[model samples]
Target: MLKWILFALCIVGIYFFFFKKPKTIHEKKEHKKDSIMLECATCGTYVSSDEAIIQDGKYYCSKECAQC
Candidate 1:
């Protein structure tokens, strides 16, 4: 009975140590970005694409520049 219990334990230990797959839970990946800059057509200044005004297919830093 003792030998059977010891053998069973050894087998269980080996199976657990060797056969089990490691946790693959990856951490949430952080994203990256640098805002794209577009040059204003009238002022020749660079503005972030998100905030810049688009007019006549040209980028402008502000509404005043866009009207130019």
Candidate 2:
């Protein structure tokens, strides 16, 4: 039983190491998109670049902040 468990684990590890799908370019870009940090121009709140609004070369966390 122990040997079978070890073998199963090894198989699983090998499968993950060799056959696991790597992130595609689009997926990697999407991940990078979320990782970017931007500060709100008005309230100074930090937000993800993807969620921030850009206006007049400044980033805002929301529409209200952008208007301010």
Candidate 3:
């Protein structure tokens, strides 16, 4: 019984040490920056796109944003 209890405790400890926490503060901040909602230059609305237009070193949500 004691051996089984020790094995269980060791397993729990290993799990907590390895994969328990979600992310560190620095990682969380980096993730938040990556997930920032970009603003549409045309309508001034928030958008979430992987690729933002870069013209004259400015960010635009889409082609419509360039027109505006």
Candidate 4:
């Protein structure tokens, strides 16, 4: 029983190491590159600088938030 368990663990480890998808790692790196998180002046919600609306040196998550 112990030997079978060890074998199963080894098989699982090998599969995880060799076949695990790297899509998430790549996506995280891409999203984090040249971008930063900032707080909205109105609602105080945090948003990526790349997608946030910048007005008067304040970052906003949406146009409505910036309007405030």
Best by lDDT: 1
Could you tell me the lDDT of residue 9 within candidate 3? 100
Q: Of the pair 2 and 4, which is ahead by TM-score?
A: 2
Local error of candidate 1 at residue 37 (angstroms): 0.7
Q: Each prediction's TM-score against the native?
A: 0.50, 0.51, 0.36, 0.50
Worst 10 residues of 3 by lDDT: 25-34
The sequence of per-residue lDDT tens digits that candidate 3 reaches over residues 1-68 is 99999999999999898886766645543454465577776677676756677666666788778766
- Count backbone overlaps in model 1: 0
RMSD of each: 6.5, 8.6, 7.3, 8.9
Which ten-residue region of model 4 has the weakest summed lDDT?
23-32
lDDT of each: 0.88, 0.87, 0.73, 0.87
- Clashes counted in candidate 4 amount to 0
Q: Report residue 52 deviation for candidate 1 (angstroms).
A: 0.6
Per-residue alpha-carbon lDDT of candidate 4 for residues 1-68, written as tens digits (9 for 90 to 100): 99999999999999999888675664544444677899988998999878899999878999999888
| Candidate 1 lDDT by residue in tens digits, 1-68 | 99999999999999999868666557556545567999999989999988999988999999999887
Clash number by candidate, in order: 0, 0, 0, 0
On TM-score, the leading prediction is 2
Q: What is the lDDT of residue 24 in candidate 4?
A: 67
**Sort order, lDDT high to low:** 1, 2, 4, 3
Write the residue-wise lDDT of candidate 2 on 1-68 in tens digits. Answer: 99999999999999999877765646543344445889999999999887999999999999999998
Q: What TM-score does candidate 1 reach?
A: 0.50
